[model samples]
Target: MTNVQLGAPNFRIVSTNVSGEASSRALFGVSYGLGMAATQFALIPLDDERTLYKAAISALWTRFETENGVAEGRKLALVNVRYDSESINTFFYTKVTTVVVADVVEFE
Candidate 1:
């Protein structure tokens, strides 16, 4: 049997989402693995609340060659935005800050 293992992407990615959905968008990308992000927001008079979100994601070195966005993280998700400061407040509120990028290998 052949032995093979994939190494994690060498990334110090510091992404700041703007107007994307509280729900993650799956776009094909070069990098693939599991991940999560911290989404936060505030109420008029109540304290801030946070939730955890996790999903399969990828980070591409470049955009996908094709238009089909089947693969996750094919491209960074985009949403409506006016100013950079309103990015966090426009989406779902959560504290999911870390996404564990990994692969699932099968033995044959």
Candidate 2:
């Protein structure tokens, strides 16, 4: 694997995660703004569902660094952080598979 440096003060780092829920809700929100109020009701449930997925993704990142011997303070240039999630269960409200990746670039 190629090492990519991450962390430069000049540029802002942005991260995003895409899921079925987010996509559907985002579309609904956009449509609602365009005079499609009916979609908003369907999208509300998605908003709640996505929050749990987001939390899981965050925890996964925290655990990744801990398990991979990566120190949080280490200065590395990372760009284009992305994450994806999928539901694994419906009953009992416990199901999500999250995958995250980032471009690590050398800053110094």
Best by TM-score: 2
Candidate 1 has its poorest 10 consecutive residues by lDDT at 79-88
Best by lDDT: 2
Across 10-104, the per-residue lDDT of candidate 2 in tens digits comes to 43433223112232233222222222111232322334444433554456456545544463675544456555554332322323334555644
Pairs that collide in candidate 1 are 27-74, 28-71, 28-74, 29-74, 35-99, 36-99, 37-96, 38-96, 39-94, 51-94
* Runs with alpha carbons beyond 4 Å of true place in candidate 1: 1-39, 44-52, 56-100
lDDT of each: 0.26, 0.40
The CA lDDT at 86 in model 2 is 45
Error of 2 at 22 (Å): 17
Return the TM-score for candidate 1, rounded to 2 decimals.
0.19
